[model samples]
Target chain A: MSRSTPLRGVHESLGATLTDFAGWQMPLRYGSESAEHNAVRTAAGLFDLSHMGEIFVVGAQAGEALDRALVGHLSVLAPGRARYTMIVNETGGILDDLIVYRLDEDQYMVVANASNYALVARELADRVRGYDARVTDRSDEYALVAVQGPRSAEILTALTDADLDDLKYYAIVPGVVAGTPALIARTGYTGEDGFELFVLNEHAVPLWNALAEAGKDAGLVPAGLSARDTLRLEAGMPLYGNELSAAITPFDAGLGRVVRFDKPGDFVGKAALERAAENGTRRRLVGLVARGRRVPRHGYPVTREGAVVGEVTSGAPSQSLGRPIAMAYVDEGALEKGSLAVDIRGSQEPVDVVDLPFYRRSK
Target chain B: MSTIPDDLSYTKEHEWVAGIEDGLTVTVGITAYAAEQLGDVVYVEVHSEVGSTVAAGDAVGEVESTKSVSDIFAPVGGEVVEINSAVVDNPSLVNSDPYGEGWLFRVRVEEEPEDLLSAAEYTALTSGES
Candidate 1:
């Protein structure tokens, strides 16, 4: 059976074309993918991200338990702050990339990808069984909505009592939005100024309606997964299944900044990461900007001459750049700072290996 | 809501063929349903050029959108007389006006196939019935 988000009916009512995404029936678009992408780039756009998994860890030893299970320094994270962390298996493969929110000293909320929820829950539960922490899966009980873009704050501030202006990036606050008690976080998948509201399933409809009404004056439209993918591509964020899988380590996937090897605590994959850091990974993720409008799609071979050196993990026409771009895992030898060619549909297109993020927000 | 003109014949894949001023030369483009499924076509790649012989189901072109890449199949076997260079430059024409300006190619049918569906039959094929 397919899963449905709390906002599934709302999406359908808006003429959204729905598709099976990560086992959930989610909207691919409402009208046009470009319009939705531009909405988030220029103004603000709402996203129903309720398909994401939310796991809560409570008990006196939550921090210590997570510290041993994940790779980030979670124990130092103060209340109201969130940190991006990763769970690796015993063999040092990534189990899931997640965000850990320190709700309190003894309570932490771990948000993971929907598809990997059960695996993550099982792994964390078995690991924490010996510790003093209790794991609870609250994914079905809560719904998540993200309001993203330049004018996101303007629209969100009007409906929520949360002092969003004071909330710095990656911070979370318990607040009320449209009269519903919620956790408003200053974070998003799209690399735009945004707020993610976590509310009860029952309050989802009213909260969505309220945001839609309040955001109308600000040009905020309901964006779906199509726009979400392009926006994140422009932002140079990695999707779990596409970019970061169990076969790819954080360092190999260009997420080295999120891994803190200097932290004074032992965590899963710590030793392997240290060794990999010293020896360097054999493959590195790089960005590919195709010369023409021909977008290099996933699974297309990345070739240097006639031989396949790598494969495209994700590719699309960048809504912000107005050109085709992609992320690919190339051999370390192919990571040379120069021009490379991506074999797209039997043709070799010259690509510039310039930088990771093809687009950046103006401060 | 756009009607597939009765004079035009269609394929199950949502391609429509209309006889040009020359009765032998038929212009082809995807139906509205095909355009809707492809979504915001940003690029088009026409591989077959003038004088290239193609089979009925042969892929002669590729249409790419932000989310997917769809193959433009030949509706009738014939030598390509002319490719629509305009649609190659601006594929959004396919989404905007799929029937007229967005026509993909004009082919001179070598052997007219009797298996082409009528406009009504094509409509039912896309609408998920017969």
Candidate 2:
């Protein structure tokens, strides 16, 4: 049986369609996914992201230990700030994409995807063994709730007197909401201004209800994993398994910028990453806008002149773009010179290779 | 529970047939249960051309949703007479009103297929599955 999040009862109460995702029974959507997707773009949407893993690294050498464990230099990241980074194997193969938040001088919290967090926690534990730091998996103790969209700040401010204005993008501030202690972060996967709330499991339901009541006038609807996926895709965010995997390196995904070789330490995959960077990758990730209504899906072969060139990673009917959009890894040369078409079923549907991020919210 | 009109016949594949009892002419569409399962319908394609004979249980068309896609099957052996152009333009009608405005095609039946379920049986089949 798949594990349930702390807010499973709340989802049941709302009659959500529950699906087993990454070993967790999570809500796919409460109602129409298009409405939820549009709500986040127009107003706001609430999310129960408790299924995400939270691993804490603390003690004197926590900073030093992380420098060797991951690609980004967490030690140099200012307190209350978070940076998107990756964990890699010895051959520079990506294990998972992570967001590490530096809470204090000797403390940091690493948020990882649900599918790969267990191994990530184990990797962090083993990598930090030589240092005077301790790695603890606090996933069971915490439940994450996110209020995402243009009206996220007002909805959150309605619940707490916390300084939402002081919080900049990618910054975290400790606050209390509905009498429940929470760490509010000004970050989200959706291409909109939003806040992610980290709170104890005991406070999950009450806090969700409180936010629902407070956000009623502000037009905040409960969103699910389906909307989250489409939102992230529109924002051009790479999911771990889809865009990053052990078989692929960061440079192959056009994410060489995430690796910080200048960080003052010998990190895992440093040498292999340097080699990969210098050699350059063969395939590059690109966005494909469908000329037809047929949506290209995962594992669909991208073709050039009736020959298989690459495969699609993630795809969806983009509500914002009003067309089908997909991410695919194609040969760099073919991407420039070759006229490409995705073999959707048996038909070769022509596509326009565009830049990443099919949608971006105006500030 | 999805509404299965007493006047319609249903397939285990989650399609609904109308006017089967009136004559050989009948309208076919996917049931609301299928539309609900498929989520938002973004693209739809019908295969059988006008005046073409299609065997019962043959794959005739396809409905593509945002997350997944399903094949639309012929309810009874018949010749395709007309297609619904409105649903072809706005596929969201499948979710909005699966039984009426979202009709896939009209078929002039060559022969009535056996073992098509009534409204009661279709409801019984889908109610448990959901």
Off by over 4 Å in 1: B1-3, B20-22
Q: Clash pairs of candidate 1?
A: none
Candidate 1 local lDDT, A194-291, one digit each (tens): 99999999999999999999999899999989999999988888888889889877888878777787777677788888776777887788888888
Reference-based TM-score of each model: 0.96, 0.99
Question: Highest TM-score among the candidates is held by which one?
Answer: 2
What's the C-alpha lDDT at position A328 in model 2?
Answer: 95
Instruction: Count clashing residue pairs per candidate.
Output: 0, 0
RMSD to true structure for each model, in Å = 1.8, 1.0
Interface RMSD of each: 0.6, 0.7
Tens-place lDDT digits, model 2, residues A235-351: 999988898899899999999998999889799999999999999978999999999999999999999999888999999999999999999999887887868999988999999
Which stretches of model 2 miss by more than 4 angstroms? none
**Worst ten-residue run, lDDT, model 1 chain A?**
A332-341
Candidate 2, position A295, lDDT: 93
